[model samples]
Target chain A: MLVELEDVSKRYQLGNLWVDALRGINLTIERGEFLAVKGPSGSGKSTLLNILSALDHCDSGSVEIEGINLSALNEHQCSLFRRRHIGIVFQSFNLIPVLTALENVIYPLTLSGTVNAKARAEKALEAVGLEQLMSQRPTQLSGGQMQRVAIARAIVSQPNLILADEPTANLDSVTSESIMSLMKQLNREQGVTFVIATHDNYVTGLASRVITVRDGELVEDEPSPPFTLQEAIA
Target chain B: MGLGWKVALLNIMRNGRRSLITLAAIVFGCTSLIVFGGFVQSMYDGMRESMIRSQLGHIQIYANGYNQYGKAEPEKYLIPDRDLSTISQLIESESNALVVAPRLNFNGLLSDGKQSIAITGIGIDAEKEVMLSSAIRIVDGEDLFPEDIEAAHLGEGLFNALDVQVGDYLTLLASTQDGAINAVDVQVMGVISTGVKALDDRLLRVNLPLAQELLYTSDITRMVVLLDETQLTDTAISTLVSAFEQHHLDLELKSWEELAGYYHQVVGLFNGVFEFITVIVLIIVALSISNTMLMAVMERTRELGTIRAMGGTPRQVVSLILLESVFLGLIGSLLGLLMGALAAKGITYAEWMMPRPPGSTQDYPIRVFVVPDILFRTFLLGFAISLVSSLYPAVKASRLPVVKALRFT
Candidate 1:
């Protein structure tokens, strides 16, 4: 198992009331599995991703990735762990506005103290079919192009897992299809594990396995029905 | 530069207007410090030179007990003519010694037959007094030459009080060393001013021989020694002290600084004002920089969260923010130094005149000296305050919770 969550729970304070964002969730993800998490709004989908990526802590129980207990690690240790092992893609495509696309892709590699960061970043951009747009800043790129840059940044370090939260929510259907195609290609060809929390049914169709979350609980976990790119696009 | 520094530089450039506003505050503060410090230093230099040239040469040598009891009984503490030659020779042995002039101080009455006024008289060595009294202004007529034994230079106030013109004769009367009254007639050669009102009102200057003849004494009060440079004053004093010990002479030496209490007072006041201004400028610059950094942090909340999620430690986040401030300080301080140096030159070139200071009789032209020490200190102050001001904001940005920061609009 690459990730194991055993009875994990998380709570949040909403003014005068305490609301449960995640409740007694138990799940396991294996290596090289492209899993999609399906849920309605405020259904603990993001909280699951947050815990898995170590961006937040679970109020109860434990989370283990690659047999290392995340609850035992401090904030700094978690950052180091994430830098070395986990890559994250945000919904808004949060590329540092000051950095060019290449620089943004090189950011995580630099953080991990990897050698030949520029070469690695270029290779990652080429993988996402954005090799020629490396020098452009985010403002100069279209939404689809920026998202591709974001995906390049995510996989530049060759992380153990990539967690994308609503990665294609802001793109149109055509652009979203292209992005989904790129991510599925990376997963199939490179055997890169992915756990994406998204609302789009098209994203779920591309994943090898799909899980649904509702009211902070896991309602379904099953293999996705085999579908072709043309069939999903139609 | 590291990735952190690169990000910091780009972030500052991203907000050009805000960065410029903060830089302007630092520049203004730094320039004010340097310019004001330079002006005060120039004033001190002027005052010190005036005091040294006008009354107190670099060093004054008096007989033992003269400073303590000479005022009450001037004759008892007089330096005899015999000892004067020995002291002068010993002082002149030092190559740095420029001139050693002897002065005899006596108080008496001056009369123009119709009017009489009490006066303080100085008997100066005619040739050496010319070099020692370089700061003394001869307002009317000419100075007394070496051969003018019967000539006197009256203070402008005293000259007017007696209603005497150049070449007019005045009767000077005083008690002799033996407690007997003596009188003499002298021709007024010049009217002088020392830029001091009270001193000028009762001042009288005459050649040494005439003063001795009038007082019926061949004794002098003290010797004033001028040096080639004021910096050599202490070295000269050390040499003179050794000579005095070797010759077994009973004498006391006072530097010009010890005699010019007013100069010390003025310097103390100026230093206090400078410190006060420094505090105010520091506060203003610190606030300006702090506000700028805080705003930058707030606007980039989501970006910072993204960085943290990408494995940037809190320390890296802080380093990025502080690096931005350091760049601001470094660039701002250098620019401020350049501007301040130019302003100092411009002000000096302008030759602006300041009104007469309190208790002074004449106005003086202002000169702003660009002291290297003041420039360096102001630069460091600006830089240091900039770094300190950003510390709080940097920490605040670093400690932000990642999930909430990511959600920040």
Candidate 2:
């Protein structure tokens, strides 16, 4: 198992009432599995992904990634773990605006203690089929290409797991399908696990297992059919 | 080093406007501080050297009770005869310490035939006085010479009032201690002037033995010494003064401050003002730099958050921010120092006549000397202020949590 969450509960103080964001959640994710967390806006999907990505800590219970207790690590250790083991792709395509496409992709590699970074960065760009647009700033790239560069940065260091929050929410259907197909291909070839949270059914159809949540509670966990790039590309 | 500085450079370029504004403040502050510092130092140098050269040499030796009231009784302040030659020899042998001259000061009466006036006579070895720089050589006459020591050199004002030439001979009648009027025919060999009006009108310089006979005393009154400028460096001057106590001479060695009290007090008072100005300039620089860095951190909240998310420790984050501010301050202050030095040098050599320094003649004399020592001190002060000012902001930036900083909108 790559990750296991047992009875994890998160609560926040809201003036007069304690609002529970996560209520007694238990789940396990195996290696190389593509999982989609489907829920409404406030159903705790975002918080779960944040915990999975090590960007946050749980107040009770335990979240284990690769057998290390997430709560045991401090903020610095968590950042290190996130950098080395988990890659995050944000909804806004949070690329450093000051850098060109190639530079932005190279940034994660730099952070991960990669040697010969220039060559590795070029290779990552070529993998994204963005070799020709390496010098272009994000302002010059279309939304689809920008998203591709974001993905390139996320996987540049070959992190074992990728946590993407609505990675295709900003794209048109056709472009979103293409992005999903690319991610699916990388998953199959590199065996890198992907945990995606989205409202899009197109994504839910592709997950090997689908987990649904309602009102901050997991409503269902069921084995899903194998996902393929053929339907996504078509 | 390269990682920190490279990030620093990009941060600066990314926010060029804010950095430029901060740099402007540093530039002006640095320039003003340097120019003012150099101006004051050069002015003090000019005033001090002129005073030391004209009257009191760097050091003066007098009898044990001489400074308090010895002038009232010259005989009482007189050095014992056995020690005069020995002390003179010793002072001359030391490094950059030379030119010891003995003087006898006596008061007497002088009559230019038409009128009579009270006069003070100074007896000195004119050769020693020349090297000792006990007095300035005024425009109208040759300085006192060894041969002329046997004669009297009249004050220029007295000579003018008496309507006498250099070759004129006049009878000076002095009342002896016993109340007898003793008179001598004194030759007016030269006329001298001094910036001090009172001294110029009533003083006369004559040969040592002659002044002794007129005063009816064979005792020494005071010893004046001429010290080389090189020997008066910061550490040496203090050490030289303290070493005098070890000599056990029945005399007190007076440095420049004791010899010229008013000048010393004035310079001392202005020292506080100069220091305050230097601090104010640097504080202004520090504030500007701190403000710019804070703004930069605020603007790059997401970037810092991104860095934090990518495994940067708080210490590393602080170092990166501090490195950026220091780099900007170093460049700005260096340019300012160069421009300031050039400006100060240009102002000095222009020979702008200074106004009478409070008690001096009207000349608006602002002397600007870009002393390398002064610039070095300013550079260090500026750089330190720059670094310290950024410390708080850098730490604040570094301490921000990744999520909080990432969520910064």
Candidate 3:
């Protein structure tokens, strides 16, 4: 198992009332799996992704990645582990605006103290079909190109797992299909596991397995048909 | 360049106007410090050299008790005539002594035989003094001849007060060594100004022979020794002291700094004022830099969060911010030093004359001296203030929580 969440629970204080963001969730994901977490708005999917990525704490649960307990690591160690093991993509395409695409792709590698990061980042961008746009800043690139750069940054470090929250929420349908196909291709070719949280069917339809969350609890877990960009759009 | 410095450079360029404004404040602060320091240094140098030339020589040698009791009873503590020649020869050989002049001091009443006024007089080797004291200005008549015993120079104030002119005969009366009244009849040779009100009001200068004759004494009060330069004062004093000890002469040496009490008071007061100004300017500059950096940190909250998510440590984030401030400080200080040097040169060349200070009778020209040490101190101080100002904002940025920061709009 690459990830394990055993009876995780999380709460937030909203004004005077306590709101349960995650309630008694138990889940497991193995290595090289393409998993999608699907739910409506306010369904605790983002919270689950946050906890799995070690970006936030679970109030009462065991969240482990590759046999290492997420709760046991200090803040600094957590950042190191994230850089070494986990990569993340966001809906808004969180690329450092000041850096060009190639620099942004190599940012994670740089933080991980990798030498020859530029060549590796260039290869990653090439994999995303963005070899020509590597020198362009985020502002200069289009929405699809920016997302591609974000994906390149995530995989540039060759992490074991990638957690993307609403990765295609900001893109149109055609661009969204292309982003999912790229992730699917990387999962198959590079053997990198993925856990994506989204409401878009184009993302969940492509997943090999889907976990549905409603009102901070997992209500369904099931397998789906294998998805391809041509099948989803047609 | 390291990633920290690259990020810092780019961020500084991101907010072009704000960064420039902060830099301007630092440059202005440094420039003011350099210019003001140069002006004060020039004043101290000018006053020191003027005082040395006008009255106090590089060093004064006197009998042990003359400074304490010579004014009350001038004849009681005079250096003996035989010892004076030996000490003069000793000083000339042991140090770079330019002029070793003997002086006698006396107080008496001077009259045109019809009107008499209280007066303090010095008997000097006029020819030697003319060589040593460039500050001596004769306004009306030629200086007294070295061989003229009957000739005297009346201060401008005293000349006016006594209603006398050149070639007038004056009688000087004083108590002799044996408590008898003795007098001399002399001709006023010239009118002179020393720029000191106290010295000009009731002062006169005459030859050594007449002073001894008027007071019925052959003893001299002290010896004034001039040096090649003011920097030679301490060396000359040390050499003279050692020689006096070797020869078993009863003498002590006083440098011009010790004799000029007013000069020290002025320096102390100006230093205090300059220090206060420096502190105030530092506070203003520090606050300006802090405000600009804080705005920068606040605006970049989301970007900082992204960097953290990519595994930037807190220390790295803080280093990035501080490096930006160091760059600003280095550039600003260098520019300010260049501007200040040019401004000092321009002011010095303009030859602007300042109004006479209180109790002084002549206007002094304004001159700025840009000492290298003062420039270096100003640069270092500005740099330190800049770094200190960045610390709080850098720490604040480093402490931002990752989740909240990323979620920041």
Ordered from best to worst lDDT, the candidate numbers read: 1, 3, 2
Tell how far residue B135 is off in model 3, in angstroms. 2.8
Best by DockQ: 1
> By TM-score, highest first, what's the ranking?
1, 3, 2
TM-score versus the correct structure, for each prediction: 0.94, 0.82, 0.92
Q: Pairing residues by index, what is the TM-score of model 1?
A: 0.94
Give me the runs in candidate 3 sitting further than 4 Å from their true place: A223-234, B111-117, B154-162, B165-169, B185-191
Worst 10 residues of 2 chain B by lDDT: B230-239
Error of 2 at B119 (Å): 8.0
Scoring only chain A, what TM-score does candidate 3 earn? 0.95
In model 1, the runs with Cα more than 4 Å from the true position are A224-234, B111-117, B156-168
Question: B1-409, model 1: which lDDT tens digit per residue?
Answer: 6676798899999999999999999999989898899999999998898888888999999888988998888899888888888888899985378899999889999999998899999999989988898988999999889798889998888888887789999999988888788999989999998877777889999999888897888989899999999999888888898899999988988889889998899999999999999999999999999999999999999999999999999988888899999999999999989888889889999999999888776799888889999999999999999999999999999999999999999
| Proportion of native contacts kept per candidate | 0.84, 0.37, 0.39
Clash counts for the predictions, in order: 0, 11, 0
Let me know the DockQ for model 3.
0.57
- Report lDDT (CA) for all predictions: 0.91, 0.77, 0.88
TM-score of chain A of each: 0.95, 0.93, 0.95
